[model samples]
Target: MELMGSMSVVEELREHYVAVVGSEPEYHEMRTRSGESVGVFEWPKGTSRMGVHLYASAGATRHGPGAREHAVELFLGVNTGSDAVKEGFANLILSVLKSNTVPQHGVFVAGNWKVIKGRKFTGWVLTERPDDLIPKLQLADGRHVVFLDALPVFPEEASYRRGNRSDELFEIWEESGLKSWDLDRDLPSVIERRSILRWPSWAQRNG
Candidate 1:
């Protein structure tokens, strides 16, 4: 075992996750009773249950040569929540995203199902395809994944560890220390409000 107890829950998750993505993890593919594929994933244990993320696409050209776009992310361990909060901790951040911090970043992220297999990246909702298109999702321990994901969307973006520390958004996430809500608010009400979901143009295009 990697002695996960010594590391913060978030750090532990990020480390294991990166390893899983690199190594030959325990892969799985789920199918319907009628023999249709539903979803798939590596099913690494101790998957992240709560997280914080900030993304601002200031555009690619705006950057000078040899520059990279920056994104900031944070995570909460499985035990990071309290009695009333628990897994719902992800929602607290959503409730506060627009009304307060990152005010213009109004769209709170929520995924209907995870693209656990075949797809290089996960999608909140499956891209429009034929009914026969293989279904994709992330399920583990007889459970399904449906929550606010706090990780940066791409490997190119910044996590608290490797990101630009001086960036204001990154600093906000770091200065919060652990979970942002912990330093200020106890926790906010669980809000399941609708957020505008964006999908790539290719998702809507014909093959």
Candidate 2:
């Protein structure tokens, strides 16, 4: 329960976000199925081309080994601007909060259905934004806020990653040469079926 003057942690984070990512984002306050409000900020095509969850980290605390003392915010990058994409990403982030689980970097979380319309993607591989696309922020209370890029993947890809090391799955993704950042890419599954022999090529490449 950290507050800065009269601004709460969420408000402070929002200010910090606008400072870093620019102040032109189309901000939306969405109501999840559970009736909880989550703030989303969307930057259109000319800008960051992403939608980020702002309030997800406020008040909620994470536990367990390797988990941060503070909570986390989630962001999803898009090749184009779409409200559907923003809402979908917001719902997913809210669901993670509802489940009481902290999304670790490079970890994969799968769902039974599609992530957004007109895409086969069904899950997320949470990781930090590369090349300082979005830098991690620290609150005045000394709590470092983490931002995770929720990279969407197909159901088979999700299943494959769950059975393998996070890095190994990452290798597969790198080898496949798909644009992992573009949620709206009209592409087939990088992986079709889960297999025990999935890493032979990865091993050879590393060996």
Candidate 3:
């Protein structure tokens, strides 16, 4: 599962992609203060149908001291086309990685799926697995689960109440002067809870 070679493989992949699609590609790296790495590549005008954003990052386990060397993530985003762009990008990724298989490990694909919703933002999901796998997918309301990862942290009821109170206090503070120190001091505990919850799970857990 280890990516044995240098970044040359990635660069080669980008070159081949640009030749086929006929557009310039851009790359960005995301690094943590501790030097953990994340890689991102964007195709501003790679194809007439869509622009692509590809992301990769190392995976870390809870019990490990640092990131798992071989574990990585590959995510793609295709914007500026019909709804088919999402599925198209997903299939392209599968095609590229299928020939370069990684033994004894799993690959996961996830992102925001575009759908017909009344609001500006809509949620959709898709998944495809090898035939030998157990077909881990959810088919409720045109959504499917593709990968198994950590469980999500759901917000509690108290958190919502505090958010509402905080909004009211902020509104009053904006309209009033600094003399409203009593209102600031009387802010609900939910505000602090909400602030803490905004941090990454690792920070919350390690804190």
Best by TM-score: 2
Candidate 1: where are CA atoms >4 Å away?
1-24, 28-43, 46-150, 153-166, 178-195, 203-207
Q: Where does candidate 1 clash, by residue pair?
A: 39-137
Give lDDT per model, in order.
0.24, 0.57, 0.29
Which scores better on TM-score, 1 or 2?
A: 2
The number of clashing residue pairs in each candidate reads 1, 0, 0
State the lDDT of candidate 1 residue by residue for 1-207, as single tens digits.
210111232233334444533433232222222232211122222342223111111110111233223211222222232322221222223222222222112122323222112122222111112231122222222221112223212111112123322243333444545343232322122212232223322121101
- What tens digits encode model 2's per-residue C-alpha lDDT throughout 162-198? 5556676677777768676665454345546532221
Please give, for residues 48-89, the per-residue lDDT of candidate 3 as tens digits.
233343222122111122322332223333323222333333
Worst 10 residues of 2 by lDDT: 198-207
TM-score of 2: 0.73
Model 3 residue 67 distance off true place after TM-score fit, in angstroms: 15
Give the candidate number with the greatest lDDT.
2
Of 1 and 3, the candidate ranking higher by TM-score: 3
